[model samples]
Target: MEYSKDDLIEAKRQIDSTLHKLKETVKTLESKENVSRLKSQITLAKRRIKAFEIANYFLENEIKKDK
Candidate 1:
């Protein structure tokens, strides 16, 4: 499925928000297990954000080429 620019942007925003929340949770957590879980989640979210950024970059380049 293809995502429009706006859709990608929204996805990126949501991912960023989630990442921020996860970081905050990490800071407040006392249990090693819980902190590890949150850290793993944060890592996954960061990877997703990178994926979105790469996708957006390619999409923008494609648009520029089409112009």
Candidate 2:
């Protein structure tokens, strides 16, 4: 499906917001004294952040093309 520039822009904004939150979560999780149990959570968050980063990169390229 084709999305308008505005829609793509909004989606990019949401992704950026999510990316920020995920990074913060990883930071918070890593700072814990005992992170044995949180290891999985931190790993999952890191993976998610990576995925979102890829999405953000595509969105940025698309936005630039839309210009």
Candidate 3:
């Protein structure tokens, strides 16, 4: 699907926001007394954060090219 420049920008903004929250979650999870209990959730969040980061990078490049 072809996304308009504005749509891409909006997606990038949302991804950035989610990335921030995911990082905070990872930090909080790691600081918990029972880190092992939340290992899977932490790992999942980290993976999702990585995926979003890649998407954000692509969106940024697309936006730059659209300029």
Candidate 4:
């Protein structure tokens, strides 16, 4: 359950990237039919990144508790 500081940093970066992609996807959604699949992909990426962030938080807490 323990993660290094680097792991936490990476997780945060990934979450940020996913959020950015989601924003771009939303902007595209209003403009193009061809982008629906890309939008769906970004939506799933957002969900996954969210889950990763939540899990990373809990795991980090657990690591701190163990210390």
Candidate 5:
């Protein structure tokens, strides 16, 4: 799926929100397995956010070149 700049920004925002919630959940969780799962999810979210950021940078550069 093609994501517009706004969509990518929104996705990054949502992922950050989720990561914060997961961190809070980790603080309260006792199960090592569950904590590990959340940590993995956090890692995935961070990767996705990085991807979005890179895409956004390229997209913006292209737009500038066009102008």
Candidate 6:
């Protein structure tokens, strides 16, 4: 299924929030497993956010080009 603009915006927001929480969790995690998991999730979130930002930028540019 395709995502609407609102959906993308919400997903991006959620990813940002999750990333922030993961960072904090990393700092608080005394266990190696917990730290590792948080780090992995944070990495994934960063990748997702990067992709979204790139897409958003491309879309914005395409809109401008159309005018």
Score every model by TM-score.
Answer: 0.48, 0.94, 0.96, 0.49, 0.48, 0.47
Better of 4 and 5 by lDDT: 4
Taken over the whole model, the C-alpha lDDT of each candidate is 0.61, 0.94, 0.96, 0.65, 0.59, 0.59
Q: What order do candidates take by lDDT, descending?
A: 3, 2, 4, 1, 6, 5
Q: Lowest-lDDT window of 10 residues in candidate 5?
A: 22-31
Count clashes in each candidate, considering only residues at least 3 apart in sequence or on different chains: 0, 0, 0, 0, 0, 0
lDDT of 4 by residue, 1-38 (tens): 56676676676667667656756665666467777567
Greater TM-score among 3 and 6 belongs to 3
* Candidate 6 per-residue C-alpha lDDT over 2-60 given as tens digits, one digit per residue, 9 for 90 to 100: 55666656665665566566556545553455566577665665566566566656655
Better of 1 and 4 by lDDT: 4
Q: Every model's Cα RMSD, please? A: 5.2, 0.8, 0.6, 4.2, 6.0, 5.8
Among all windows of 10 consecutive residues in model 4, the one with the lowest summed lDDT is 58-67
TM-score of 2: 0.94
Instruction: Tell me the deviation in Å of residue 32 in model 3.
Output: 0.4
Task: Output the TM-score of candidate 6.
Answer: 0.47
lDDT of 1 by residue, 1-67 (tens): 7666676567656655765665565455534555665676666655765665676566556555545
> Where in model 5 is the C-alpha error above 4 Å?
1-36
Summarize candidate 5's per-residue lDDT along 1-67 as a digit string, tens digits.
5656666556656655665665555445534556665776656655665665566566556545545
The model with the greatest TM-score is 3
User: Which candidate comes out best when scored by lDDT?
Assistant: 3
Q: Work out how many backbone clashes candidate 2 has.
A: 0
Which ten contiguous residues of candidate 1 have the minimum total lDDT? 22-31
Candidate 3 per-residue lDDT, tens place, 1-67, comes to 8889999999999999999999999999999998999999999999999999999999999999999
> Candidate 5, overall lDDT?
0.59
